[model samples]
Structures are given as structure tokens and as C-alpha cells.
Target: MKPVDDDVLLTEVQFKELFRDQSAIERYMSGPHPLVLGHRVIRDNRFLVKISPDNLTAFKKEYPHDPIVDLLTTPYWFRVHVYYDIVTSEDFVVLTHGKPGISDLPVVRIHSESLFNRFPLRTVGNRTSSRSR
Candidate 1:
């Protein structure tokens, strides 16, 4: 995620005050932080979030560290990872932000690919960092 120069972005002091012991900045600087990095620029690194009625809750719980969630809780902001389209090779992703007007029904969005910009889920030891059904 690109760092913002304006005060509109979260402040370090505010983060410290809010999280107290959180190490978001450190995690962001190191590797592919799930919260900061978006979908991979290629065909593989797409953050494939299969949304459904059952798995949606679990997904949100699992990615509590996701900054997009934080942004959504506030106003005027949300997170969307662009993916690559297989046919046209366009940049896209099903993006959502701000308050939802309805409690049911999911929206349709486009997905495209980026050759260089991507966030492949990391593998730790024997398990994959990505969650899939």
C-alpha cells in the first residue's frame, strides 16, 4: 500500500494510541503483509476471496489484520485489490468500500492481472498462508 503524505491517512501516533502493542508498520516493511499488499500483478498472486454466506464471517475474522477492514470502519475509504483478466489481461478486482446500503446480496466486479504488482500469499513451514475452500 502506498503511504499517504496527507493527514487523511492514519497517523503513527494514532496507531500507537489505538493499537498500543500492534506492529503493523514493522509487518508492512518486512514481507508481503496481508494487510498492506494487494493482489499479485500476475495470474497467480490474486487475493482470491471466495465470498459466500458461510465463509464470509470466517474470512473476515481470519484477516482482522487487513487494513481494508479498518478503512471500511471509518468513512470515505475501502480496499480493493486489482487482478488480471485472463482474456483481455486488464487490471481489476471486486472492490468494495464505505457503508453498505443492503445487508444481503454481493456485488459483481471485474478481475485483471498485473505482471509486476502482486501479493502472493506466503507459505509458512508446511502450510499455505492463503485460505481457500
Candidate 2:
């Protein structure tokens, strides 16, 4: 999702030991941008590290064909689905699509995910559904 953080790197053991919810921790670890570095133990999980504008050579070399700078700079967006979390009985996000939307203000669709077995809470509005997913 973003550039990896070099500072505050943690090992698998340290990560497992540090987090209480093993399942949630596992998701974080296995996700595309796992916070752990050496097997992904970085502290900053969300925001991407700023890529050096001048020295993109090495960065490009490290990830040939995968243009990090372009991907980061280009207009990229994701289509998110707003659904209710069955376990929590509250709203949750499920990423349905990725890439910029055709319309600037795309209409939000409220649908009950098949996995949720008939959950409620559906609404449609111009509001950004809290930018779900």
C-alpha cells in the first residue's frame, strides 16, 4: 500500500510477543504492507515513507517494472463497499475495486455482503461513507 518504514523494525518473535490479538496481528503481518520489515516489523503501518525525488534510480532498481514513485504520485483510488460486520454488528469495509472512479462523486451502494447472513444498516447519500475500505 505504501513505502516500508525502516525505523522501528521488529522481528516476528517481537511482533507476536508484542501484540495481544494474534489473529488481527496476523492480518497486519500478512497484508500487502505489513508493518514488520525483516519479515515486516516496521512500526509505522499506515502512511508511506516519502520517496526521494532525486534518487529514484536505486528505488527503481530495487523494484524493477514496479514504478513506486509513479504509483504513489499518480491518481489512484479504490472502490470500497460498506457493509455491516456480523461479528461486531457494526459497519465494516470490504474493498471491492481499485483504481480511480469514473465520476468525481460516485454514488455509494449499500449492500449486505453474502458472508454476513442478512445484516441491516443500509443508506444512500452524497456523503463519503467515511471513505470505507
Candidate 3:
């Protein structure tokens, strides 16, 4: 991430406008829900989702793959993960499978929003936070 330009400043109105633009971009990029960081267990399998700077650093140490993690969200082992060119906006669960060295495990990346949007399901929304799932 690049440092903020200290020399640059914005008025309150400009800041608010920027904030709104950012929110729209995030929603369009990620989906309806906002991003959150944490770990969860789905269907008795362990998952670790790291998107925050601190957590990404920690995940990088073990997995050595920054900005990418996978989740096996189905009984048939369908893999899913957050997708972004530089950083992830979509919320996803990274299934650890009760093991270490997450990068060692084979996975296929899927943009959660795209998946849900492209194939709208009766129960599935555009995108869901891991906690909600």
C-alpha cells in the first residue's frame, strides 16, 4: 500500500464525496457486504480469512501467498477465495483444513461476487460475509 500524500488535503465536502465514491467502488468490486477479517469453521473444517494488513502479514509467513486464500465450501470440495488484482474486496473464507502451510494445499480461486451474481441462487445473495455464512 502506498503512503498518503501528506502535502495533499481535502475539504470536508470533498472528503465525504471521496468516502462515498470509495464505498460505491468497494460495493461494485466486492459486492453488497463489507469486508471483515477473521477465522471460521464450516462444516467441521477450519478456515482462516486474512485481509487486514496485520493478518495478511501473519498469513504471508505461513502460506507465503499474500492476498490469496482458499475455502472448500462444499461437500464435493468446491474451492472458493477472494479475487483481486492487487487486493481483495470480496469476502471469502480460507479453509485451513486443520493443517499448516496453506499454500501447499491445492486450491482454485473464485470471485465470490461474480459467482453469486453470475449464477443467482435461491438462497445465495450477491456476496456474503464469512461470519454470515
lDDT of 2 by residue, 60-130 (tens): 56656643325334442456667675566566675532332454232233565444324344543433333
Best by lDDT: 2
- TM-score per candidate: 0.23, 0.24, 0.16
Q: Give the per-residue lDDT of model 1 (tens digit) for 32-64.
A: 333333211212211221112233245468777
Q: Tell me, what's the RMSD of every candidate? A: 18.2, 16.3, 21.5
For model 2, which pairs clash?
35-42, 36-40, 36-41, 36-42, 37-40, 37-41
- RMSD from true fold, candidate 2: 16.3
Residues forming the 10-long window of minimal summed lDDT in candidate 3: 1-10
Name the better of 2 and 3 by lDDT.
2
Whole-structure CA lDDT of model 2: 0.41
Query: Which portions of model 3 show Cα errors greater than 4 Å?
Result: 1-36, 54-133
* Candidate order, TM-score descending: 2, 1, 3
What are the lDDT scores of the predictions, listed in order? 0.38, 0.41, 0.35
lDDT by residue (tens digit), candidate 3, 22-125: 55425323533323233233223222332344443444467654223221111222233444442544445553222325344333333344333454456755
Order by lDDT, highest first: 2, 1, 3
Which number leads on TM-score? 2
Q: Lowest summed lDDT over 10 consecutive residues: which window, candidate 1?
A: 42-51
